[model samples]
Target: MKLFVKDLTVIDSSVLDYSRGIIGQSWLVDIVLHGDLNEQSMILDFGIVKKLIKSTVDELVDHKLIVPAHAKFCDVMSDGAFTYVDAWREHGESIHLACPDQAFALIPTEQITLASLETYLTEQLMLRLPNNVKQLDVKLREEKIDGAEYCYSHGLRKHLGNCQRIAHGHRSTIEILRNDERDSALELSWAERWKDIYLAEHCDMVSGSELSLSRAGMAALTPEHYCFKYQAPQGEFQLAIGKSIVEIMPTETTVENIAQYIADTLAKDCSDALTVFAYEGVGKGAIASA
Candidate 1:
């Protein structure tokens, strides 16, 4: 499927300020984009394209990313389009996106006019048959190491200040082709309470494990709780599973039903989480009522 961005620019021009950070100047909107497809021409489970789009948006609109290197251009602007590139890298296999056309070009941070370029790209993307061609992509275009730093140190007390080692950090330049974990993730994120477990399928799982205790089961606990397991084709990891708690007595219920039911009941019974996962596999339960 093709991705469609309804509006490319946020209309307001006067509200941007340093207090709220650069993201405060960004437009918020629902984004729908396609994942990579396979030999059967089916959408891969990796959600590569989807993640790329959202992450790119996040990079452009979230965290400390709003700071424009060019402070001079912060003024005299009504509109601009901030595009993101989702980068991945492998030796040979990869996915990529390119400018739909060259009509849209990137200006230095100083020349950007807030909503001006954004509005232009927005209207351009909406036009049919590549006439406007303002669409941009989050894709990898190169292979190189991220930048490094050099620190300094003082004598006697041996204080620290400058860099001393070589550090290599960079984003991936390959598009995800298929990943069962993220496939299950994005699908669940869209649904209320739970999503279908195409991910928790008939695979290498222990027989006694409650397959029904959907990993989405954590939603029953807390969206903020860090509880998730992910496996990708190359490398994999889970985050934020610690610092969570689910208050439920499973003596009367099967393990299959316990986690989810507790999640559901906790949602109703407590103002705060009953169980907490402080970090990793470490978990705590039965919080005192306030």
Candidate 2:
């Protein structure tokens, strides 16, 4: 990690003011090195890095009573510096209006020191980005990994922390439908792979499910055996005698309604009555979009 800086580049303050209300308005100047991605580093996780930059910049602007241009200035150093540092002064107000190269005027210069900035910003971002961020070339490195790996906004994964993949994963925001214990049976209307399942009779005692039905058997049964009217016979039932671990001790035959039982059982396994409802809601919402 290395640093370089310059004065602010805002030629017009009115335009900046007009853009202030953007909820998550943020800006970063990526300092790219003439190099390639670190092969051994896997993917750069920008989740925490962005957070740290935000907090650090906020501290500089809001808390420290510094300006945005200045805030942006100091954030570069948070990523740490190696050799040469450059700042592309944004044509506006900055911490130090004039660099030593331009003119050698030495005074406090009305600019605040960045002593406490690093501690706070590093701490905030350390919670999310890779370790030793203080040593990385952040301005260039951080933005490149935005959709690569470790998106804190979403859960973590490799090659899939990307925005495209994130959209493919479960989204936390859709409206969840409300349901109850009474919704025991539902249409096994989706894929054959996802069958209508029921909560085990002794759900609390079961690790997951003692019943294991392969896609072949499930394919054989499906909407037919799972129909609300179908009933299991009076004798013992075995889904796969060929398999070593077979489903044992079948339930009462009066439990003729397999569909309702499956829906209700799925509800209990979720550990909440409305869980299946919420899950189904999300699934349907996804399909609607598709």
Candidate 3:
């Protein structure tokens, strides 16, 4: 027998890429189970699939930084409670992160792709599934957007949950309105500005001497990089990313603040009012007007 669920949940995360540095992403999940019928004449209850399967997948990867441990330019270490990662591009541009252990999913692969993640997740799900379940299939895919979208990585020290992790991020879309009229040009421009970027807080900036990275992480730094460190409720977090890939924000990087910032920026040169709809990921976001 086979049981399946589509649109299981969305995993919003940042992945360390050998060439692109840290890239944010959001993937919708679909799951299938191949198993014999249980005593209730069912493969698995729909409620259980939604609750158990969804929760498990979320706990494994949602709001975390996915690291390709086997990548040539990637290095990972742990001090039991926290994990430190150093990932670099071929030309030496790099990103470093130190956060609580729960903030990362160190997949055993050379690259973090849909195929790799699907295989990794399937193996993990099988271990926790019931005895009747003989096999599991997991599919991950990105949301289809007709308009402008971008990938960005950021941290919220004020968040009490997994969002506090310094390296987690999202793939987001932007909508701009000038005098209540849709402005596709403005949307595309902003998306281009933030492509594969890191949204950082000005307050989080720190000197290289004050960074909490490993020796190799510090060695990978160049003059063109910006370093940031902060202490959240979870633990001390640190990062070093190339300056060209970072956007320093005067305020927090929350979707509410992002929308307001866009509205305020557009308001400067506008003779009329403007509105901005900023999406953090799929289906949910914030709106602001000026």
lDDT of 3 at 89: 83
The clash numbers for all candidates, in the given order, read 34, 30, 0
Better of 1 and 2 by lDDT: 1
Report the Cα lDDT for residue 204, model 1. Answer: 18
Local accuracy by lDDT, each model? 0.24, 0.22, 0.89
Per-residue lDDT tens digits of candidate 1, residues 15-72?
1123221111223333333444446564422354345444444333321122232443
Worst 10 residues of 2 by lDDT: 8-17
Winning candidate number (lDDT): 3
lDDT digits (tens) for residues 265-288 of candidate 3: 878877787889999988889999
Q: What CA root-mean-square deviation does each model show from the true structure?
A: 22.4, 25.9, 1.2
**In what order do the candidates fall by TM-score, top score first?**
3, 1, 2
Per-candidate TM vs. native? 0.21, 0.17, 0.97
Please estimate how well model 1 matches the true structure, expressed as its whole-model Cα lDDT. Answer: 0.24
What lDDT is reached at residue 121 by model 2?
35
Comparing 1 and 3 on TM-score, the stronger one: 3
Please give the TM-score that candidate 1 achieves against the real structure.
0.21
